[model samples]
Target: MDKVNNFELGIIGCGNMAKAILSGIFSSGFLKPHQVTAYDVNPETAAATEYEFNIRMAGDLTNLTLNTAKLLVSVKPKDVGAVTDSIKNVFAPGKNTIISIAAGVPAGFYEKKLNAKAPVIRVMPNTPVLVNKGIAVISKGKYADKEDLEFAVKVFAGLGEYVIVDEKLQNAATAISGSGPAYFFLIFKLLVEAACDLGIKIEDANKLVLDTMEGSAEMLKKFNSDAGHLIKMVASPGGTTEAALDIFMKKQLDKIIKAAVNGAFNRAEKIQDKILHGD
Candidate 1:
């Protein structure tokens, strides 16, 4: 399928996450190597990505749309202004979808910067995408339509799981699946540290924590059981698990978690505000 239904993709940044997406899509046969192009401010990076992915090196954004494109802006939020200014000046209007994987900044920011009705799609993908086990949250801009949303889903489906949300809920969704990996990582680290503090060897503690986590996650997926159900199943009336859980509850672990997540959600909001407003 040349251009994957005539949908050439121009990636504006060739970073690690951008490479993860390219790997997933190429592996899934969603887009052939020749159908995508990589552009980066650093020619070295652009050349490296081109050689690695066997994709074309885009001289400019305009070249991507010779056959109509879904230009994927995979840059950092701090660089959005520079990227958007470049695209706004040189990129063609219509016949192309602007898909951004930048966190916190909404599609509106791009549209506003472009100062035109460019079809924009926003997605938040976590680092697990590097391992092909990530989840991405997708949302459409005012100019994006059903077909855009469908294609976006197909684009990210190879990564793992995906969910579509209204643009209004994009940041909230981001606060979870987008920023959620770090939360788990932090908790896992703490568990390991606590176990080691209790005199368990590091290696043994790692095995215990990792095996327990993997099995627990699998149970949630396999049995489709809520976390509460799993907790109840594991914590018998006066068991060790119950004792630990009681201590956690007594320390207001649940409230702390809620507050942490809420803080993340609000920080996401502030990030957007900073993107749209400044400093």
Candidate 2:
């Protein structure tokens, strides 16, 4: 029998997230295309991915598990059970490590479906991973140890930033980092619209907002201070920025944002409950 750690990395789905991860892995020179294998239920998607990435495609879930020591389960949360069931037999105890990126799916869920000793890691990765700028939060299961978690982190580091969190906090991480990009994008859209409403041309508004956002992000990256501190720095006592900020404070923007974040957090928790209990 092949040693569990001797096999290549395998991905069990070829969706957008899978593609993004593979792209980052290959681009980062972390793994060669041939070192990775992928399987997808959709034949067309598999074939397209094979053609685009020049990586081998597995004939089935079993084939993927047989060839890879580390498996990344990228299917939707609803399909996790079926996918796990199909490949569970191939998973060797204390050998293979399972990493799941399905939203709201817990590591325990996979461990329960597979062998109790199976190592599972749960990850919450955002859409920015498509562009190699994603933030992924990872958590370990009952059997997974520091080594297993580190291996999962290495794989995701190719895509972008990653943080290790307790399994209990995975849902909160999903709400923040996993769903964070959409919130930023929505805010950017509103900012663009507001700019247009203020007499700026649509194209120019988009450019202005995008550039400003990019620069602002860079500032955050360069500075060691927190966002609140940075905002205070920008909004001088009686400046135009302060004027807008004053209105935002009066309107209780912070409360609104907290509520929005809590809404996402609550929804993530509910989804996890539904997946776990079929509620």
Candidate 3:
């Protein structure tokens, strides 16, 4: 357990995202229980997690991580409105770095609401964090210094790969990674369902999908060839694979993929501008 020096880790809203982070933190052994504090609206969740992690849980946000360590706000976006008002009086501006994982809630929004000069780092982490295979995209706010950004990076890195992008790229990253797991899972589900419809047993089809997907990914790791070349190699001319490719091409699958991605981007923008703002 190589514990990192300086700053206790604190988490607000000990929900799924918080739990995922706690698991990562404990497994990494980079921080100790005494160094972590949490508060949640759900008393049961707060109590259970506190006991399980052997960490302190504050019943109120006033006595929670905000009063002690660097804070991570993992509350849902809609619930952020309540949270902002609740923590306003308790925030210690210079002493704590605030990291928020709520989607569509900009760091500017928090700065304005909290009325503090605390460094804020906005993070968009996907549900895959639950399995510690998440992809997180981070963007720094006005007051967040390099040290603060580095600290946020270290925390999220324990969950999975993380990238720090410019603020302008945050929305795109959110669309691609934040919502990407659902898109990929939908594709996997369709493939498995189609296989079962084609007379393959459902269980076998699922296993086949899982194994083939993993094996194909492994192939990419082992081969230096680009995806196009690897795909070409697998798709022999006038063979079943080629026939399938021809059908996909005829159906403009590439165009469909692009359209799907674009749709997600457009929706993400709408979520930020319209839903979050009531515009």
- The model with the greatest TM-score is 2
Predictions ranked by TM-score, top down? Answer: 2, 1, 3
For model 3, the superposed segments whose C-alpha errors exceed 4 Å read 1-7, 275-278
Angstrom error at residue 198, model 3: 2.1
Per-residue lDDT tens digits for candidate 3, residues 1-279, read: 542323377788888888889888778876778878888888889889988889988778766634565788988778887877787887766666779898887777778778657678999999888999898899998898998888888788889889888876778887788888888788789999999889999999999998998888789878864788899889888899999889999999999888888888887777777534566
Instruction: Please provide, for model 1 over 19-67, each residue's C-alpha lDDT reduced to its tens digit, 9 standing for 90 to 100.
Output: 9989999999998997777788898998899889998786865555454
Q: What is the lDDT of residue 237 in candidate 3?
A: 80
Q: Which runs in model 1 stand beyond 4 Å of their true positions?
A: 1-7, 65-68
Among all candidates shown, the one with the greatest lDDT: 2
- TM-scores, all models, native as reference: 0.94, 0.95, 0.92
- lDDT string for model 2 (1-279, tens) is 745553468898899999998888888787898788889999999999999999889898887887788899999878889998898888886768889999998876777788878888888888888888888998888888888888788888988899988899998887788788888999999999999999999999999999999998998888864788889888888899999988999999999988988999999888988887775
Q: Write down the RMSD of candidate 3 (Cα, Å).
A: 3.1
Stretch of 10 with least lDDT, candidate 1: 1-10
- 191 in model 3: Cα distance from truth in Å? 1.4
Candidate 3 accuracy as lDDT: 0.81
